[model samples]
Each structure stands twice: as structure tokens, then as C-alpha cells.
Target: MVWAFHTDEPEFCPQCGDSLETQSTEDGPRPHCANCRTTAYHNSGVMARTAVVDTDRVLLIERGAAGDVGAWATPGGYIDAGEPPREAAVRELEEETGLEAAPEALTPVNVGFLEFDGGESDVAVNYAVLRSETAGTVEAGSDAADARWWTRDALRADLPAEKNNLRAIGMETLLDLLDDRS
Candidate 1:
């Protein structure tokens, strides 16, 4: 299925100073530059989420800003251009939680559609990571306000009530994956 996450409205054409017209494409209706006949396609962003666990506890981060502020989520972010999802997972894990992990070490768990505010949607690629070696070094960094280990009970108790937010990043699915692995 087509993932609808972000939208862009181009009033004028970048190539020319003409107004953009609406045109339907395979993906969806997009803005078309009349002067240059260029269509501006807004594609969905891809995010990498990892369920990093240490023994019986899973690592969660409290978001500092943007969507889901103060809500707990797996350490993840948008995948950079030209970077693989696994590599992005590793990079985001380190950036958000200060946990060093290898790309090959992350195990693919699930793929789900996440819808955010502003009509943005993302294809969330979830993974299960169990690298106990770096568990002790995890500290909140980057976009995270705080990072901590939580038992399943604590996690279930503390997550936000918004089911859409939780499903967007496959938080519940990740928790289930952690349980299955354990």
C-alpha cells in the first residue's frame, strides 16, 4: 500500500515563475508547474525503529520536542538519503541513546505505516536489538530528553494513551517482540 506521510504545496514553479497546476500521478495528486511542466511529488519518509533490550528491560526515550513530546518511543529517526534502513537504525540508536551498535546486529522485526500530524505518514521499519554490552552506556542525547531502562510493566504503564501515536512507530509491536525474544 502507498504510505502517505508528508505533503508539499508549491505555489510557484522553481524552474519558472509560473503557477503550479494540480496533476494526478501514480502516487497521488501532485503540484505541476505549468511553465515547465514539472510535477512536484511529495514522497513518504522512511523511519528506522529499534527495540533495544538488555536482559528483561527495554530501552525507551522520552521525546524532547516535535511529535509525541514527553511520550516514550524506541530510539529511531528518519533514514538519511542514500543510507540503508539497518544503517540508519544503528546511527539513530547511537544518536538518541548513546548506544553503539552494528548494522548487521539489528534484526528485522516488522514494517508498519505511521501517520503523524500535518497529514504526514512514514513507513516504519522496526528491528529487535539485544546488545547487552552497550546497555550501561546509554544516556539521553540528540532529540531525546531522557533515556532509561524499563521493565515491561513500567513500559505498559507509562506509554501515552494515543494509540495512533503508539502504532505509528510500532511501539506496541516492538514491546511484543521484546517479550517474544525474552
Candidate 2:
């Protein structure tokens, strides 16, 4: 489930320091400002993507950013404002890994919350399966250093060099979700 933090207080908006009306009760506090037509807290929506693979191995890419740098992750990113989750998944997969993938369906996988320095983070929704009639070559692009497929055991065993703390979450959850399908 997604959580939202809304407030009308000037603190919420960097541009406008307008006074925000606060509603307080047993449910806690919520801020709404009519003039700004904004809430104090923003709701970060779900980011969905597919875990594409070749043979028994799954694909992963090294992140280019200092955050999670050198960390291995499936080629995926945030769902766009209007686009569907599946489309976003395919687009991200192609952009990051340079491999075209057609996602079959949403295979639910659990992703834990990640806390990063500088307060930047996202809620990730990952899928277990996607297919490609022709497996094209992979080249790293965008925010990726390298792209390659690794067997499940191999991927799990070499976790130290992979910077992302969520790698284990992604691998284990994808495996469990795929098991449900079979």
C-alpha cells in the first residue's frame, strides 16, 4: 500500500510560504491549502517493472549513480505519470539494458522500503516474468554500467560487490513469484 503526506503549510512548498490549514484528530494531522491548491505531503506512486531473463539466468545491470553505484539491478524504473506500469517496465528495460522485452503480466513481488542518503528513495513494484521471441544483445545505457544475465545461485552468492541492499529482496521475491506461476 502507498502512503501520502499532505500539508497546506508553507513548509511543504518551497516556493510558497503560505499559511496552511491543519486538520487534526485521532487520525493524526493533515494539511491542505486552498490558495496553493496543494497538500503538505506528496504521494509517490508505485514504480513497476519486469525481471527479464535468458535461459535459467536473470538479467541485471550495474547502476552508474553514486547511490547504489556498481550495484546490480534489473533493468527497470519508475512508471510515468500517465503510462501503464507494463509499458513503463518495457521502456525501462529497453533503455537500461538495450534489450527489447514484452512483459506478459504483472507478477507480484515484495520490495522493501529503501532509505538512502540525501533523502531520495522510491517504492518499487517488481514483476517476475517477461518474454522476448528474439533475445537481442544487451549493452549498457542510461544509468547502467553493465548488463548481463546470471544464474539465480550465482547472483545470490556474489552479493558483496553489488552495492544495492535491495538486490537480495529483488532476487528472492522474483524467485518466489515465479514459483507461484509454475
Candidate 3:
């Protein structure tokens, strides 16, 4: 998700210095501003992942940011407000892997959730596209440290059997995307 989960509750309202109190809303419990009467709703941030496939290999990028630094994952990121998730997926793909693609050229593979140890979470939409059409050589860009094509065998051997990699949806989605190419 694009939003970070806060482990602690807010003691003050964002709009005013008054203390924040819990109020019931249609969306459930939320923080209410005592002075401004403003209500805060918690929402999950949407994210997308692009699986660029070449033969039996899939493009993977090493994360450069903290939390998962140097760990490999599909090229993707949080969707910007007013932007479609597919477009965000393509944009992230191009930014991280230098592979240009369009929304229609990409196909949705799966949707999943990623939860962090600090209570942060994201709703991830996964996509895949054949590499024959996309242009430009693959290179690490944006916040990625590196980008490379990993064969299915290599992924299975390198990634842990447990759900611990940066792929977000785990290795099952990776295997499914690879199998779909057959």
C-alpha cells in the first residue's frame, strides 16, 4: 500500500491542536477533530507490479530503499492519485527496468495484499507482458539497485519456500506468471 501504517494512535488532530477523539463513522471508527470537527478516514494505498517476461525468465529488480534493500522484486510502485493502476504499473516498469509499455499491452495476473511488520500494508495489483514488444534494454533505474532476468528455475532455487521475498504476492504469483507464458 502507498500509506504507511502507524503503530501509535494520534493524540492530536491534524487540523487543530485539540486532542483527537475516536468517532464512529459510516466507514467505522475514525479520528475526529474536536475543534475543527474534521474526521479522518483510514484507507489503504493501491500499488501495482509488472512482470516483464522473456522466454522462461522474468525481469526482477533489486530494491534500493530501506526495509528490503538489495532484495529482488517485480518492477512496480504505489499508484498516484487520479492515475489508473495499469498505467501506474507500466510507469513503474519503465522507471525501474527501462522497459516501455502501455496499459493495454499489460495483462493483470493477480491481486494481493502485503503486510509489513510495522503494521503498514498495501493492496498490490500484479501484471504481466511478453518482452518481445517492449523496447529499450533493461537496466536498474529509479530506486532499484539492479535489474536482471531470472529464469524460473533460478527463482525457485534462490527465493525461499516461505513468503518472504519482495515480490509482495509471494512465489506463487511468480510461478503462475511464468506458467502462463507456456
- Name the top lDDT candidate: 3
Model 2: how far is 111 from its true place, Å?
A: 5.9
Could you tell me the TM-score of candidate 2?
0.69
List, residue by residue over 42-133, the lDDT tens digit for candidate 3.
Answer: 55667899888887888898888857876888899999888999999989999999999979998888888877765566789988889986
Models ranked on TM-score? 3, 1, 2
Better of 1 and 2 by TM-score: 1
Q: What is the lDDT of residue 102 in candidate 3?
A: 75
What shift in Å separates residue 98 of candidate 3 from its native position after superposition?
Answer: 1.0
My TM-score estimates for the predictions, one after another, are: 0.83, 0.69, 0.84
Q: After superposition, how far is residue 4 of candidate 1 from its true place, in Å?
A: 10
The sequence of per-residue lDDT tens digits that candidate 1 reaches over residues 25-47 is 88788778767677765667888
- Model 3: colliding residue pairs: 1-122
Candidate 3 Cα misplacement greater than 4 A, ranges: 1-8, 11-19, 26-28, 160-167
Q: Candidate 3, which ten residues in sequence have the lowest lDDT sum?
A: 1-10
Candidate with better lDDT, 1 vs 2: 1
lDDT score, candidate 3:
0.80
User: How far out, in Å, is residue 107 in model 1?
Assistant: 0.2
Backbone atom clashes (below 3 Å) for every candidate: 2, 7, 1
| Alpha-carbon runs more than 4 Å astray in model 2 | 1-27, 105-121, 130-135, 165-169, 175-182
lDDT by residue for model 2 (1-182), tens: 22253221234433366666775645576565557655554444456655764556667788876456788777777777778777787788778878775655445456545444444456777665544432567889888888777666776677565464445345567555445433
